[model samples]
Target: MAPTAHSAVIAALRAVGVAPDAYGPTLNTAQSPRDVDVVGEGLAGEIRAVAAPAALVVWDTSDEAVLAHVVARNLDIGVLRAFEVEGLLRVSPDVPAGAPVALLATQWGERRLAGLRTLVANRGGQTVAVAAALTSPALAAVTDVPTAALASSDEVTGVPS
Candidate 1:
């Protein structure tokens, strides 16, 4: 069966860790992107456990690497660059039997779960459950002990300022 859009996105992310050759691009560290995605904040330090010093951490929140990958994939590569996407859904391969770890996403996040689930399964994790929000009574009832949830908020303290 064909992979879903979410799965495809996940595949793209897991595919990003580079086998960098010599003569790589440099980071200023002072610059900022006008927008960003896939904020894997702890990935660099986490990667140190598995990689040598020169290994390229592709998920680093740097525009140059991010843009390069985006262009290479011919994917939409801009900030606040919104669009509606339809995704295929399928049972993840090699999901651990009733594993507690799983994906929960909506909008963009939901789209990436397809690839992400495979990565999770590879890491001995299981994306056993997923949902966009707690608004559904069925979801709320079933997810009494959900391990993680994701959302944005206008509820931030200074947001209305």
Candidate 2:
């Protein structure tokens, strides 16, 4: 199996003697609503930010409502249960309503650009990836890394490049 972009990033960080501890939860702006810090009627309220990824349907056996949202601001990904609005300011890194945000299942598809629509520019010196999904939006923008190569390739890259 090929090394994941996350693994590769970690390896590079280690090569430079950068401790993973540097980021830790500090780098984690996108947090789960169940984390206590976030408490509200819904994921948006829990996140305390608007447009923080919504209604992410997942495949689970129990069939209980499980949704995963991303903090488009800091590349933070999280899952939560569905609920009503908590009434807060729209401050998260999520794309605005009707901004053509695609709720994908983390699988690369023809609409890669739509996925990139969710990413917000880094704020407060946050470390964020070019694509919110990391390499899916990058698949089209794939380039050589040492001798690494993409299994399959396309140019329908998403996000603001």
Candidate 3:
């Protein structure tokens, strides 16, 4: 089964060897309710910011939950320089992809042209391939890399150009 947000958050905390109870009060944001607004969004932001190649530890099993907890909590204790599995895998030039190639597409048919370049750069400066729900002239400007038409943003998952 897919992990719930609570499970994911708990796992993130434990990854860093933190006691689950140590997390301060969960905040409620002006946005959605289920969006369990952690008081220090900065904590999550820091973890994600340093995670190059966009180390995305998507918890498919219980194992990842453990890993997530460690990452989440340990990162908050101090500015740790240790590498997580995702962090290592993301930056390792030896990986088959050399650099990860991301597919940027929008489900809502918004203009992807402006955002694609920045998203790719932000995500470990990886090569970007643009996919769009509908074709647009702006996408044509992205010539140095590959571009394609995707049925929806969801299709971009794990799809390399």
CA lDDT of each candidate? 0.29, 0.25, 0.31
Model 2 residue 11 CA deviation (Å) reads 22
**Per-residue lDDT for 27 in model 1?**
24
Q: Per-residue lDDT tens digits of candidate 1, residues 123-149?
A: 454443433211223334434323222
Q: TM-score of each candidate?
A: 0.25, 0.20, 0.28
- Point out where model 2 deviates above 4 Å: 1-105, 118-127, 130-161
lDDT of 2 at 27: 14
lDDT, candidate 3, at 111: 36
Clashes of each: 8, 1, 14
Model 2, residue 36: displacement in angstroms?
A: 22
Candidate 3 lDDT over residue span 1-161, tens digit each: 12353344433222222111111111122233222223123224433333322222221223223333333343442110112264221222222233444332211123333443343354444543443222345655667756543222122222343
By the lDDT metric, which is better: model 2 or model 3?
3
Model 1 regions more than 4 Å off: 1-38, 42-89, 106-143, 147-151, 155-161
